[model samples]
Target chain A: AAFLVAPLQAADPLPSWNDGTTKQSIVDFVNKVTEEGSGDFVPVAERIAVFDNDGTLWSENPLPFQVIFAAAEIKRLLPEHPEWNDNAAVQAFIKSDVAALTANHNKGLLEVLALTHAGMSTDAYDQRVKDWLATAEHPRWKKPYSQCVYQPMIELLEYLRANDFQTWIVSGGGLSFMRVLSEQTYGIPPQQVIGSHGQATFEMKDGVPTLTKTLETVFVDDKAGKPAGIYQFIGRRPIAAFGNSDGDQAMLEYTTIDNPRPSFGMIIHHTDAEREYAYDAKPKSSGKLITALEAAPTHGWTVVDMKKDWETVLAE
Target chain B: AAFLVAPLQAADPLPSWNDGTTKQSIVDFVNKVTEEGSGDFVPVAERIAVFDNDGTLWSENPLPFQVIFAAAEIKRLLPEHPEWNDNAAVQAFIKSDVAALTANHNKGLLEVLALTHAGMSTDAYDQRVKDWLATAEHPRWKKPYSQCVYQPMIELLEYLRANDFQTWIVSGGGLSFMRVLSEQTYGIPPQQVIGSHGQATFEMKDGVPTLTKTLETVFVDDKAGKPAGIYQFIGRRPIAAFGNSDGDQAMLEYTTIDNPRPSFGMIIHHTDAEREYAYDAKPKSSGKLITALEAAPTHGWTVVDMKKDWETVLAE
Candidate 1:
């Protein structure tokens, strides 16, 4: 089919991925899928694979970057929400004191998410996310967060999709949040994003069907929840999985576990501190790629080195 | 520009939708968008139009037909859910007694939805919907429910897309349920279907991010809620709106009210009782099309007589 040939062209849709083991691995997978009569010619149904957003597809430096965006959004939204002036969590967010946020990062971040994301309908949340993405820049890179996406991984995504693989981003980030930018940045549509969600009620408000968010949390697609999110969102077990941190370990393990045919799992190791912040197995910010690294040989998982494998970092 | 032409010639994309009005509407829209001089030329960002599923795109004869499919699915799923044997609502669904269901349809349907759709994660619900859709045949039509799709409307959808309009299904049915067959039947991808949804909690059951359904309702995309759903899901007001009943009037009004350029608001009035079951003002099943008819002149909504507009009914 003509569709099969589109992915076979060696010229990378994202040339910035460069050429090395990571790029070669991506090319080999495409070849296997597109080449007829090859032992690895995966049926289209089983060809669907999913990846994580933050650390897997791009760099998440200076903090889980979405948090920064959320914090900024919360501040921008503060005027509309005057109650935040009295609320301790909202005050900390508006102040932009990392110490105050890190003092209770988990709860404080949740508070920020609640304040910014909750109360409004899901549609409002999506619009806010889109609006923020249009202007929001990475704190350190000072570029639009969309540009912060990894060049090699972006190539891999388009390459896989070109070869008849349907790729999805199964992330712990909020579904509405990721959906706002996934199609533009990753080529994955909103339906392809499976992630954390907030509580919603189906109601007719002034004759409009609205999905209003509640303070209550629905599902958080992180850590061990990655694999479950994949199953819940995609239904079929993914033939391949990609991630960069311990949060993605369960997803990796789930993908490579005893399938009838060959399955793939790859981890993006942060080795280039100059180009991007690199950390693994540290006390507070350890991305926990070490455990997956040690298990790779036994589990048949592919561990990718950012410094050694990728020729380029970010797509221009 | 090359990218736009590739998908069109790749396959006989809309073999079913080849009629005149439907086909020309699409061509005109696409010409406007792709060409420079057309006043209705929409930028890619704003080139979005949403449609309702069920009666709008396909035959909804057997009572919002998806509900009928769900009823059968409940029967098949009964062994897994033994509680149905003792539960009154479940028993009514299992026994297939409309009289019993009518007595308590709202609560009964809600109860059935809860039991049938609950406990399992979102993915499971999607799979169940898909499985039922694949095999289940409509009662009176005795054809695959997917085949029940309107041939002319399908043409309209394809024509609009050829012009660069991104079409979406804003339905009152469950999002996951409609998503199962939408891509194959309507060519509108799963992400494009915005409909009623239930609350789902993200939980790690055996190390996966599983979205378990809570006994809570999310947004219901029907009636005046159509506009809200379009704004929420698609992020823009539609240039064109197509629907069958009064449930879609708000969407039409919302689309046509105060638009800067030319827009279309269409209503598919079920007037062919001989060819297809026709009822405009039925007390029970009309779904409020009367108000739309009365307001059509004021709203400038085009009332489409199913008997007149469609040259063909179902996709052969």
Candidate 2:
């Protein structure tokens, strides 16, 4: 007599995702585009998936992490620079006056950025960001900010990579800032991260080459600029786009609309206040999801409700 | 029963390269950087190698291929617009008067490019380039322009790739034009090709997303700008750089000068007058190697003698 046993089933690629329509949709889309002989199959070279960094991949409740870092940098550097104390905008920022900080079309924000982000060598700036992330902890969780990345999204990134897709981070954050953490937190390398960029001058300083950041006109990578950035950097239209805010609306449209390949668009709806912060139209900083949320249904985008779709919040 | 057999020495990775110091240097550098226990070993992610496209990778004798394409386009589009007939620059270009076309800092050249390069959707421009390449032949070789690419360089690209190094093209050619042939000719993807970039606007035309190329301030990827382009696009500093002219001096410097990891720099001296063209200090178009050639020895940059080192010129 012989006993028959079924071969072990393949392990779940997205263990953090709940076994529901949302999870099934992601799996189905990957299978449709990746499996050989499928009608919707896309070649591996064209299999690009772009994700917005701030709210989609990580928590951005009170402020985007970069902004928080900037604020912290201001405090840390204030003692050495007494000239900043005379500026009213700097005083308002020090007092935590949100309205004052945002007033005058963010003149104060620009000033703060010029102070913290520019006037240093890029290597020095990279070191500063790395050091801050190593020490800085989220106020609410009391854990490193890098540890607050979404578990489901991280798994999704890995799953797409496993299927021979190139995962890219298209963010509104500073290119230098996002690149420092992206490879460690999301497995996305620096070359694959596209973000808002400013002018950097290259020169040889004392026989050593150096790149210094400058307070030049920054190319903002939000809203319609996202699509422009994509065209300039990637040189190919992505097959899938994921975002959680209005800033990413153009990118989503650019990804899915009239794409020759079968494409996908997903919106991460922060509906779980218990597990994570919830906001859509009115966010404390950065994300505002009204336009993208309203357009999602018409575009056939899957709206992922955090409460219903994700088994876990932060990456383990 | 065992028959004594020698393991077939792995097929020559760079077979088009002659058995000489130049070829051996490349193989030795790759081995030193890729071997597991070597002190100079670099991680695969950090092993970036950049190459110049025009003279370094292919034959840029009378003019760079893109300039030739532009000249062809001027003639092709001239009949459509009578106003262009009134323009002196257009007439000079049509007559192939090099001195007149280059007068006033290549004012005629710029005029030709504006008419041929801008005022179309990027998609339309891409299709036009593809159509031109498919039909156009090099006047010297009487073959498709793509076939003029150097065989030794192609093999070098493959050899580096086999060693897990990412090869990138940082050229002075138009970004979109270089991207069309880069993948098929060099086995490099569009994302890895960085070049001169013009502003493109994203908009919806007839409910279809479109990117219209504009005659704006183009960021030239030449001379000092090469390193800037690499910084903006690739983020990480390259470990190896290859070029054929003075325009690439900054990039060569940025790549090898005090790089954290072991680095290599090579300049291809155009000396094969019979097989290709031989002009360094006084080239007919684009590439001019004087300052870089003088500086190479002090920098320890290997200068390649094209006639002696390359067993084959054009890709077979």
Candidate 3:
């Protein structure tokens, strides 16, 4: 029986997954897919799966890491934007006052994004993001943003890829931000990232055709937006979707909306207060969507309790 | 001698390469990188190399195929825009008259792109492009657009990947268009594609955060724009660059510029009149840029005579 279960357990790429229902659930699904005669044999084309970055694959606590990067970039860029120094958002951002910036986080975040990401070609913004990611360390973790990725999730991604599932990162974070690290951390290439994007323009600068950033907004891959982003980016309903907050509810909902084969949706509830903060149903920042949470049982979605389910958090 | 040559050739992944200065140059570079004792052994992080898609990896004959796709999409969409019936550019596009569209090709292409790609979110646009590529047959080849890929280039892509080189397609064509079939045709996932784009917006529609297209111009990756696109998308300069015609000249120039190890630049000159049309320095559409062609010799760019160098063409 142990030998038989070995094959079943080994089906999960993350074999070291803590012995919990979350791990068991994943193992069962893999068994179903790998079983020669199982009804859930997914075709190669439909085997594509997409996950939200930030809160989904790793911790977005203490603020989305990319947001912090943007804030820093905005401060650096403030010298150029002399008028911005007087601007309320820019001033708050320059001061590094998290309270002020998060007072109206939505507007503040967008302002920071615009300031840091604007005035350059899409290519320039991308380069800036890459340059920043190469050196920037997370405030709490003191690790390179790339190094802050969750070990269990990273294993899950590799495991999925080994099983012929093409994984992608669809996040609300800036596309450029995610593109910088997706290839190295998640093994998902830059092209596989779909996220919020600012407008870019084609212009002749010094007699060269360049893509310049415009003051126009493109897609913002965020809450209630995940399904739409998936529809746009992947062009298919993901057979499997994993997310960690209410922002991911729609993606989960969209994934479970009746497909031919067995579909799986899992939510990582941040229940580990010691390793990571545990807060849900809060008024601000990754607030849990009560409706989706309540309906998880009926919808066949697995609600993962991080404290109980994950034996380890960050990858060494 | 045969035994020694076989081992040496086998060591190089691109073995079909001609035994000449060009072949030796490639072999020398690969040997330096793969040989443990060599000083040029680059770790995986620095091994990132990007490629230009259109004429570099594949043929862009009979005009950029993506432009043709846009034309077809625009014709299909024209019925909905009665205003376009009287519009000269749209009228020209509807009749499938290349001359009319080319008379003002930039604006005309923009019009077609705007109409075909606008109003939909970036996600929706990608889906439309994918659907079109699946069913739409190439005008001349009469095969699915995805099947029109160049065989030699496909092998080259796989060959590079086998050696742990990450290949990307940076084209002047729309990102969405190439992304549709890139994975199937070139093994390049959609995320590795960087191309021309249209404007998009972030909005909450029907209780979902979505990216909607606006009738605004974004970046057009062409000419000097190639380097910028590669920098923005891949954040690294390519060690090897391949292209045909002048549109790819900037990319070739950019790739071969001041790299540490041996860098390569190759141009596929269209000389096969029978297998494919051969016209350089002609006033026709897809006319090659003369300055880049003239500068090739001085720049150490290997000019490949398609008729002579290639054993096969198209992915048949």
Q: Write the per-residue lDDT of candidate 3 for residues A71-99, one digit (tens) a residue.
A: 77876776777888678887777666667
Put down candidate 2 lDDT per residue, B211-277, tens digits, no spaces: 8887675878898789888988889999999999999999999999989899999999999899999
Q: Show where candidate 2 strays beyond 4 Å.
A: A1-7, B1-7
Per-residue lDDT of A147 in model 2: 94
Model 1, B1-316: lDDT tens digits are 9998897774644454344564455445556666666666677656677788877888777567777876887878778977678888888776666566667547777778777777886667777777777788888778888888888788778867876778888888877777778878888766577877765555445644456765664567787667755654444557788887778877777677766656777777887777776877772443547888887778666677677666677778
**Interface RMSD for each of the candidates:** 6.1, 1.2, 5.9
- In candidate 3, what are the lDDT values of residues B1-316, reduced to their tens digit? 7876786655545544445665455556656666666677776555656666766666666667777677778767767877877777777676766777766546775667667777876667777777777777766788876776666667677776777777777777776677777877888766567777654445445644465766654677787677766754554557777777688877776666556655677776777788766767772566475777897888788777767665666778
State how far residue B61 of model 3 sits from its true place (Å). Answer: 4.1
- Give the candidates in order of DockQ, highest first: 2, 3, 1
Chain A TM-score per candidate? 0.88, 0.96, 0.90
- Two-way lDDT contest, 1 vs 3, winner: 1
Model 2 agreement with the true structure over A1-316: per-residue lDDT tens digits: 1233334557799999999989999999999998899889999999999999998999996678887888889889889989988987777767767678788988888888888899899999999999999999999898999999999999999999999999999998899998888888899988998998886778878978788887674778888888888888889999999999999998999999999999999999989999998889988776888989999989999999999999999986
Which of the two candidates, 1 or 2, achieves a greater TM-score against the reference? Answer: 2
Instruction: Kindly indicate the candidate among 1 and 2 with the higher DockQ.
Output: 2
